[model samples]
Target: MAEIKTSVTINATQEKVWDVISDIDNEPKFWKGTKEVRNISKNGNQISREITIAFRDQKCLQDVTIVPKETIKAVFTEGVIVGEKILTLKDMENSCELEALWDVKLSGKMGMFTGIIKKHIKSGTEQALQAIKEEVEN
Candidate 1:
């Protein structure tokens, strides 16, 4: 499993930041590699999203646990990865800080590209956080 953590501070309220991050439907707008988020199934606090990522040829379904502004945790049920990802938010004066922690385990044929996947996650996290910051601050 590869454990990656990245964070970014945005010039926006915690509420505003949460509003953008928590919206699972609009995630592709700020997230890197994500192409589309659909076939959403919600059960109280748990949500399952079928996502099409740019790096993958097929779409994958992942279960996500949402706690409003506090945290969002996700685990993939299908695709190249079979692990969990977590995103947390913190209050910092007038601005808000968002942290993303990813714990990814490769599955099947994708396992061979672990090194490439790790690099993708490392760079993608940085780019994604920056994109999120820009989207929220705009």
Candidate 2:
């Protein structure tokens, strides 16, 4: 599996950072790799959704769990990719830290290009974190 992790320190409180990251509907705004999100169902802190990824506009089914101000975990259920992506938020005295962890691998014939895909995802994740930081700090 391709594993990627990236983090950013935002000049904002945990609440501010949480407000930005927890707004899952606005995910595509910061996550360039995510083209669109369609909510299929919701149960308390858990959600089932379909995400259209930028990789050839592939659609992936994900089961997501939200732990309020702590973390958001999305596990890929059915798609071209298989694995999980997690976003964690840590509160500092006056600032907050946001970290993203991705452990995934391409399915079927696309598995051969996992190395290339890893690089792309890593860059995209860094960009996404920066975008979130900018949004929260401002």
Best by lDDT: 2
lDDT of 1 by residue, 24-129 (tens): 7887877767888885778898888898877855687899899888898888899878788899999999997899998886788778777778888889888988
Compared to the true structure, candidate 2 yields what TM-score? 0.98
Clashing pairs in 1: none
Worst 10-residue lDDT window, candidate 1 = 52-61
- Give the alpha carbon lDDT tens digit for every residue of 86-111 in model 2: 99999987898899999999999999
- Candidate 1 — which residues are off by over 4 angstroms? none
CA shift at 2, candidate 1, in angstroms?
1.1
Per-model root-mean-square deviation over C-alphas: 1.4, 0.6
Against the true structure, candidate 1 has what lDDT?
0.85
